[model samples]
Target: MDASLEIRPAAAADAEAVAALLTDFNGEPVDGPTAARRLAALQGIETVLLALRDGAAVGLCSLRVVPFLSADHPYAEVTELYVAPEHRRQGIARRLMREAEALARAQGAPSVYLLTGFQNETAQAFYRSIGYGDYALAMRRRLI
Candidate 1:
């Protein structure tokens, strides 16, 4: 981590930057209002960890805590993780993941999981390097 870089929880004021980062992740534009609403909706059960460099948001990781019928404690799912193209390979993503995991632990979550596109080999390698292993296949259904 850079000495000037800081990682902290996202705030209402971060709507624009967060939205921009999310847009990068989704490969689409996200308007400010929509991003604000999404962030507000995740206020309680989820957390967005932001990495700032010189007071600018550079990266983010969103974590959601959920209950599981088979577990004594709730588990956490990492819904999103992104870093600016200019900031890649700087350990920002790893730092954000660590912070998100720490928050999940503080919330009594027993484990944390995440999913990435099958074609994203770089992401898969990174996750594996960080000790994350595949436990099961992820299936999804689109209702729209």
Candidate 2:
């Protein structure tokens, strides 16, 4: 990570920058209000960590803590992780994951998990390098 980079929780004031980064993550243009709404909706159970460089948001990670009936404690899942293309390779993503894990533990989650698309070879490699392994298949159904 760069010496000047700062990592912190996303605040309502950061909605615009955070939304812009999220737009990059989704490969679409996200308007400010829509992004602000989504961020507002994630107020409690989800934590969005922002990596800032020189006061601009350059990266973000979203972790969700949820209760699990099958487990003795709540678990956390990394739902989104993205670093600006220009900021890649500087260890920002790793720092974000580390912070997310710490936050999860502090929130009483025993473990944190994430899923990278099988086709995202780069992400898979990164996850493996960081000690994540195959666990189980994630199946989903589209209700819409």
Candidate 3:
């Protein structure tokens, strides 16, 4: 872990920075207020972790315990993982993943799952390096 970094539960007050960080990694602008509201709801009912460095928010990841309908185990879904561009390659994301896994286990999750676009080779490599395997197929429908 980075000496100056701290990984903790995300709070409503960190919304704007978290939203902006998401937008930056996602390549779009997100309405801070809307994002904040969503984050508030998730915080109340789920686990969303944030990475802070020197008291500034720089990374965020979402982990939710989701049940496997046909299986006996409930697994964790690592939804969004992001690190500020300046903080990349510094193990910030890796630390966040470790935190997420710990959180998942605490929530009684038997496994952790994640998905990435087929062309997102970089993210795929990262996930694989972190010991995630490709077991499920991710399908999506574009409503736009």
RMSD of 3: 1.7
lDDT of 3: 0.85
Better of 2 and 3 by lDDT: 2
- For model 3, how does the per-residue alpha-carbon lDDT over 1-144 read when each residue is reduced to its tens digit? 468999998877877888888888888888779778888777534677989999998998889886668777676888889998898999999999999999888877888888899999999999999898889888889999
Q: Estimate each model's TM-score.
A: 0.96, 0.95, 0.90
Sequence-dependent TM-score of model 2 = 0.95
- Model 2 regions more than 4 Å off: none
List, residue by residue over 1-144, the lDDT tens digit for candidate 2: 377899999988888998899888988888788878988999888999999989889999999998888887888999999999999999999999999999999988987899989799999999888988999899999999
lDDT of each: 0.91, 0.91, 0.85
**Sliding window of 10 residues with minimal summed lDDT for model 3:** 39-48
Residue pairs whose backbone atoms clash in candidate 3: none
Q: Which ranges of candidate 1 are over 4 A from the true structure? A: none
For model 3, state the Cα shift of residue 91 in Å: 0.7
Model number with the top TM-score: 1
TM-score of 1: 0.96
Candidate 2 lowest-lDDT run of ten: 1-10
Q: Between candidates 2 and 3, name the one with more favorable TM-score.
A: 2
